[model samples]
Target: MMQTLPTLKKVTTTALVLLGLLTASCKTTPATQSPAQGALVSAQDSHIAYQGRIGHAGPDAAELYWSGTTIRLNFEGTTVKAWLKDESGDNYYNVIVDGDSLHLLRPDTTRRAYTLTYNLPEGKHTLELFKRTEYDRGKTQFYGFELGSDTKLLPPPAPQKRRIEFYGNSITAGYAVEDNSGKDQPDSTYTNHYLSYAALTARHFSAASHVICKSGIGVMVSWFPYTMPEIFDRLNPALPESKWDFTKYKPDIVVINLLQNDSWLVKRPEHDEFKRVFGTTPPSQEFIVNAYRSFVQQIRAKYPDAQIICMLGNMDITREGSPWPGYVQQAVAGMHDTKIHTLVVPYKNTPGHPDRQEQQQLANSLIRFIESNISW
Candidate 1:
């Protein structure tokens, strides 16, 4: 028998527990609850649909990297629990139950079962666990899900025909998008890549997206020790040898949102990244163009037929009169590839990362561009 769900104001035992900030639900099973009370489902089962660059940690565990890596499944039960592990223990996930994403789930650093929701009316329900943190937050291992006795996994959701890939930095990673206070500093608490222009744009097109991004990465340089070039082809950004097999998943459209970090770092030669990439002097326009051009060539080599959008912006880099967009245009022009075009979203102008509203604005722009130019 199921207990009655508590109203927003009602408090009750047997409550549903959400990760990170605790929220109450009726008959919520605690993470510390014994899994022996439920039936286990391996994450590798065909009924689970994972969309992103995922490698395997073990025979039963799925290794997740990148910002928008997602794990989705359908099941029959009154409750659901996810068994997951995080390297840094700082990652956040959007737990969508039956299409309603009212919970933000944060997994423990070590493997454990987290009750995503519980005590629901007995029936069918859909579960989508959308990763919200970027790779720097650290990798995660999904062991699978735990369901109530007599409940079983259902067929996975149909895959989307349109596949999209985004290579970018903080803006594309959706850093601070949830921080509307306009503070320039950001933390994982306010970062949500799913709300970023890249992921939102993919959702708009009903496309499956692979978001290869870091908060401070750039084409030529990055705030971190690595840059986009070093990790773009990697299945795990943390592992250099983990090269992604391009033949596995192909995107019909590719978007590159970068250069924002490079623009800022170059202005400060004293910064470690600037000194490492370009010591003592700022890189010339030709240098920037060539670097950008080389990265595009790499992408073109990997996805010969995929249309590439050499993008910049929604940052000060794309502010009026900035030469960054011109550099992107120059690089694309020299390549002379009709399939490759340049786009720069208007600078958000306000300080800090673009909030949810601002990200939506950027997504709206990209969606319109795709609608006007690309078909399919």
Candidate 2:
């Protein structure tokens, strides 16, 4: 009783339509705000420079996000307020000022302005706001920043030389990397994409990073109904119909860490509960290899000149003689593409996913690989 592609498509379409209606109804009405103690700056103001996949950038507001996307501004002031549109309770962000320290902030389910900081000394400072939550949480719209009357915004920092894009599942999303609770567990409090291997690797190379990941998602199969191939191209991750133009931003390198979920789910015992959920038996080896190869080819088509690295492990898939890594290798070889390569990271993390320390180790290995194989 395998679900046919058309049946799956119909179900996905119906679900998306229902979700769209519900989201539209739940949209938080925008709130009016008096100008801050100083100058009122719109999102399009000269001082505010945004770096990431901005979905909608109007004169007054801009939708900013995708994990690791950042917005930066330099100003001379002791306090600043940001106007944001928050529709879900899951949107969280990190506000860093003058590189002093990290401050985590979560917006309420209301469209209004919020004070980012108000206790700094009255002097020149730099502020960077990063979306800590992944795409699945939803998008945040930034209306503008309000500064003290005497404060003035400055130009942004120089752009990074290299840029990398990561595609994968919860591991790439940095799920529970911070749990350190000494127990194998999954909790939102412990998930921090900022500390994931992709982000850390980008930091080591001083490169701009973009993380496109969803927990339980895989290249060939997923624990959920949707897979990466079905949603990776969406401009609005939550809205499947929103298509993202690939030419807008190009990465120098693309790292894909997928198939782990597929391995975990597809290898389930015949009597496993997932068999009833997925309505199909384990996919054949040929099917998995072909699916992976096709997905990589799709990426190659999008980024023809960029170097592609297919990575696996730091999970059960990394065990000796694991068929997971072999599938990736075979897929690469079948591509007949020199730019594609493979790396198998040993499983050295705790019982569950890799913790922060393990993420750092993986980042180090990836950095070494990039330095050796790629020009930048």
Candidate 3:
């Protein structure tokens, strides 16, 4: 005959005891938390762990964050995620994950931070971040990267990243050089030269580079008709027409080669007006100098840690480069921990644009600098 076990309360007590016994008999361990716990982490009161200032004021300064010698991070799992912040307005970043290129997102007012969700594989992963100024292309201060949570571990086996960024003027835009050199047209513009130095550099370095250069723009100032100095002092002009977003498309390195057009000193209505104001025929060199300084300061304020490389291309717009180079050096000297480089490239056979040889020479100079200062 089947016998009744026990009363309701008695049965409950018995089940509890059995459960306790089973739990005790088996190994009790806490379940490991996934990397998602670090997601949506709060920004308030968060700190930037690896803040190293050793390379903050030199050619490698902008690259300080990614120099591998200074900045370091350890992760447990394969993938990782976090938000990036740069109060100094420095361009220092290179976060990749899971065979995907990380994005250099702009600050979202609604979100109140520049969020980055990187999916790194397992094991220990290295995140390299660096600076590249928007103007002058000079390398300066380099602050390390910030982390939301150091607790998150990389996966057992890590995933890899293959990305690059190209920053330059019309050359990077593939302006004028199309299909091939012989077939390209004048209207081709620098954009046609998609295979220009910037692009080729990215290719050589195996990076997904971002280009932010405009044809006639310069560091502290510009030429042609409107200069950054005159524009800022008199009127804040609208942004120029370009496909690449200045606020977006953050680049690892920026190459600048302006001043070609500035030396033009083209006679225009503005020149006549300037003569009336100064009681002279043309704008004085002092005016140009003042303008350049002011413009450079503004740029520095914008990208505090960017590694900027300023170049004097092969073509010599003004036979006498004394005024331009001297003014440039003076401006760079005033900035804190800035790297200023000058390249005296000779390219005159191609007429308006530098020929293939000239381009190669420019690339050689840049390559040497990158080899000495930055890592891919």
Candidate 4:
């Protein structure tokens, strides 16, 4: 009787097992299921999703996006790979990843777009693509995460800070030059050139430098269609609605080079277009003097504690052209408690531009000036 009962129990167990197998055959792999909403690639778990934005202009503003997640970035490699478009030829960007100390990377080719790659550790990270220059008027480009591995990338410990701020026109911006190691020939404007005088000087003094300059822009004013009085309209337009908010970074030393651009408009011939733009009779030497004074005054208002060094005569001025040293002298004449210095460049490289030799010379002169005059 007991054996018969045991056999019955086995039969029931087998029937249930057969039913479970049939049910399993009706299901599919979870991987084949639809992607979850706002799903992103995660660095932590290979299965979890990530969300991040691409374009960043503020201390931590969104400039790019990939379903809204920050990507891990590093700088221990050569080429930085990014998925970007080539629609406009002038949309330039800078990369900031928490690397050795926040490495700012520039594109190496004219391929319209590229991707940046690096080996990083495992952890939460932030990748920011910042719009640096725009050649066209209304062309807009956005960048963020296109690709990365499943492993989380970790950032190194933050380094100590030594900061310096530089202000001027195109020259200070490394305009029309190549990378830091480019040959001495004029190519295109590369604000990435670290060999430029300002960068070199900053490196020599072991400090980090920030650039706040645009091509064809000056302080007391700018060229026609826009004058010194109209700069607030132009430079101020790039700024956000807040007063203390500007590109989100402040520097200790701000070396200004606006006089060169100002000199062109102020010293034009008696019947030149600049004279017409000002709606005044052609300016005498006195007009130039007064203009320089006003420019210095505006700079002082913006950066009160900054040690302002006014630069003149870059690669643009010819030997016989109007001397900027004299103009700078007049601007800082009555100012006190301020350490105002002047630099006169005697050589240039590009056609109407500074060559490598001249750049080295200018760098030497400026380093000496910085050491002797400004408190590094």
Candidate 5:
């Protein structure tokens, strides 16, 4: 006989208080409740854990995810389904089961339900579904998960203690890093956020990663109207009004990789367009330096204790003598903040951007830098 769980509406505060007491009492035991007791779990149920830049839009929908945001659940069953809402045809995800890569699914509809996995051996299993695309693809809402009658939700894995927040442009978003097509252009099929240096570095350090990035955005200027300064605080990347409450999540380390787009855009012949839009003439080196400094200060204001690393490219901002690297150094120095540091990686010389292989190298270099410098 299978237990029927309480519906979302029927779950009273008193019942929840009792359940919390029960959960606290059994710390050493598995967190799953007996499914035979007729306990139904809703999407908003406390047992279901979420990670990385996630925002709740409504009672049933989880929103504001960039690449690498994940939803996890532990349940004892042979099948599970996720009700996902992604209007864009380009949204994709990687499904992992019991620490194994299972399938890649493209939720190509406005609102559709997907069977994440099925027909597994009956026992406790874990599922991790990762969003594999960046914010530009579109936003996805996780309504909830559906488990089999015999199955019930278990406690999710313990959260990672070390957390890192990466802020940058397309390179940080892993834009076209996997393309290897030499076109120097972004293609949806070639973009894989999981392979980016930010993700790879997070995996190396066993840290929870939050990627706050967009393609072709910089501190002073962007390919589009908005720059990192204008949009970094938003809950939804697509909506300017959706402000993110920064206090909800804090990072031990904050890595800012701006300047690549700015470097290329500011120096180009059509730089007047930037001046027109930004209400300034061609940005001088001094203007860029001050802008970068201010942006770093903004991050400091948000994360007072975080170790800030200002980095510039495995792309155009190559070598020690470059003006771009100087700008980053000058920005950190001007702050007079000892907690902030700077790093510059060697150029990869890839056609479009650092491909997977190059990103791996960059990740390795960053890992070494962190290992040598930061105590963590």
Candidate 6:
């Protein structure tokens, strides 16, 4: 029997949360240099900018679980500090300072303020903390930022005119993209969503983006208990009832890269998910095609005019002889919608999840596709 998930709640036993953080390895440590004296900015500060479907735990805390969730603030100061709480002590982040390349940061389970950046040149600077791990790693809370004396927070950065949202699996989440070992799976600390193709493509077009995806999820079934279709519109991934307000963030373009897991999972009749979804038999050609098409139609119903790109992988599912791309094609053809399109990133023959370099290559292919087709 499937276990019932609790309603997404704002509060939990602080002890268990703290214990989870305290249980991390001794190597996991927070930055020791906190601002001795300055203002403790509230997470509710108007000057701060946020992206992703974040849920709030309190008036001054933002709970973020999805990859690519970001909190940005501009301030003029010599030293900057931030207070972050890691739910499971497994999440990683990309600390992008002043739009620089990026510095990897792993916040310890501690609740104290961390000195994010300090001793910068005397001028205004931007600090963006980007979540690099998928939701399964656990939720993180953003308490606020702190700035030393003789500093003030600047106005929010200008919003991007272009907006894009991605729906995909491990590739889109940048899962294990940094690991090169031949292991079946690797640590979550190596995952970096900031370097994913979806993030790269959005940056190329200066589009604000939201990634609503989980690893192992497919349109029809997933390796886990839930599929993307059941969780796509949720504000809280674990809570089916915590629906996201689509009106708040409508994308000009939406990209759907699924079916990869289903392509392989459907063939495994003995797999638990397969047995639950299609007992004793594999999904037929028509069932598979219609399953994908129906999900796309669900998205269309939410965004009436957004261009939808039905994409396959840089994985085995997009191999030369793979029928996955054809399924997407047939689905789009059946939709009869001009805004809906299909494309496939050529298969990457690399082992495990595509490494960093391979992810860049996939991003380039997708960029080229969008350039050739979408005018934006």
The candidate maximizing lDDT is: 1
Local distance difference test values of all predictions, in order: 0.81, 0.74, 0.38, 0.44, 0.74, 0.80
Q: Quote model 4's TM-score.
A: 0.60
**lDDT (Cα, tens digit) per residue for candidate 6, span 1-376:** 1112111221322111111112111121222322223666677767778999989887768889799999988887666667787888778777667786355566666675665565677888888888989998888888777666766677788888999999999989988876657563658866778879999999999999999988899999999998998999999797778889999999999999988899989989989999999999899999999999999999999999899999888999988999889989999999899999998888888667777888898889888988998887
Q: Native-vs-model 5 lDDT?
A: 0.74
Q: Which stretches of candidate 2 lie over 4 Å from their true place?
A: 1-37, 57-59, 183-186, 269-279
TM-score, each model? 0.89, 0.85, 0.44, 0.60, 0.86, 0.89
Model 1: per-residue lDDT, tens digit, 1-376?
2222222221233335663221222232333333333556676666779999889986778998888998888877777777777899788887777765456677767566777777766777788888988887888998777776657666779999999999988888889887767785567878888789998899888899998888888888888778888989999888899899999899999999889988888899889888888889899999999999999999999999999998877879989999999999999999989999888899888877888888999999999898999887
On TM-score, the stronger of 2 and 6 is 6
Model 3 regions more than 4 Å off: 1-175, 178-185, 189-191, 216-250, 266-281, 318-322, 347-350
- Ranked by TM-score, the better of candidates 1 and 4 is 1
Query: Model 1: runs farther than 4 Å from truth?
Result: 1-16, 19-38
TM-score of 2: 0.85
lDDT of candidate 4 at residue 196, scale 0 to 100? 56
What is the number of backbone collisions in each predicted candidate, taken in the order shown? Answer: 6, 2, 56, 32, 8, 0
- Residue 33 lDDT (model 1): 36
Clashing residue pairs, candidate 5?
3-36, 3-38, 4-38, 4-39, 5-38, 5-39, 5-40, 6-40
Please provide, for model 4 over 65-136, each residue's C-alpha lDDT reduced to its tens digit, 9 standing for 90 to 100.
111012334222222334333333433444444422233323322222233334444444445444434222
Model 5 over residues 1-376: C-alpha lDDT tens digits?
A: 2112221222112111001000111111122443332243445666677777787766656784687888888888766666666767677676777765435666655454566665677788888888878888888877666565567667767888999999988888788875656785665666777778998899888899888988888787777777899988988888889888999889999999888888777766466547655554577778888999999999999999999999877986774567888878987898898889998998876557888888888788888888988986
